[model samples]
Target: TIEMKADKTLSSVLSARAFNALMMVDFWNPIYSWRRAVLMQYVPGTASFDPESSRYDLEDAFITNVKKSGLYTQGDRESLEIQFISLLEVELEQHQKRIQAYLNHARDRLKTSEGLLGCLTLAESRR
Candidate 1:
């Protein structure tokens, strides 16, 4: 979890329109479907994610510590993969809902505004 400063803007706290534009362009625009994650894992293994120092690597703690304990039985990787996929699907669905609501609000704003593009139709002469 990358903690922002206490005075972070609302847009910073939540997802912004720029993120939506990128999602539309890069990943193929999604309407009813939820967005997909870049990786099935929490973080890809490498220098990018250091379990020793990063505050966000808590997911692997169970596999590393709890699984390593002598008293505990080893987990089934296939079952764990199934559960992780289910959990991620739910998370992405919620994110999709939020982005949809945000886009709706933006469209409403544009519709109500007196800006040039706000007019219902463009005249051929004006072009």
Candidate 2:
């Protein structure tokens, strides 16, 4: 019960942080576009841009857009993109591991509770 209540607060905090991060990344960034592409890969035909396109194509579009807005160079783009994607992948992997661990813990707790309930039922039958 306490965990559920805490999760409500945690959910709000996480949603806000996620939204902030999404804004910070900006829609033009290839990383953001690539993330969306990867997430939506399983869906049917899309109304917007095709998600099956190469990440390099996405990066080129990002570079072209950025160049239109400001002075970004071709050389720095690769280095910066490599760093951003690598760091993002590492963070995502860590979150996945944490989620898996939490699920395993919850499953063990459920099994323990079920075993206890079974024991109680057996005792009631003996009476």
Candidate with top TM-score is: 1
Residues 45-67, candidate 1, lDDT per residue (tens digit)?
A: 42123436432333344234333
Residue pairs that clash (backbone atoms under 3 angstroms), model 1: none
List model 2 lDDT by residue over 1-127, tens digit each.
Answer: 0122322333332233333333233333434455444322222231222236411133233333434332233435544333333334345455456557866775675578786687578659756
Error of 1 at 58 (Å): 12
TM-score result, candidate 2? 0.23
- The ten-residue window of minimal lDDT in model 1 covers 38-47
- lDDT at residue 111 of model 1 (Cα atoms): 68
Clashes of 2: 0
C-alpha local distance difference test of each model: 0.40, 0.39
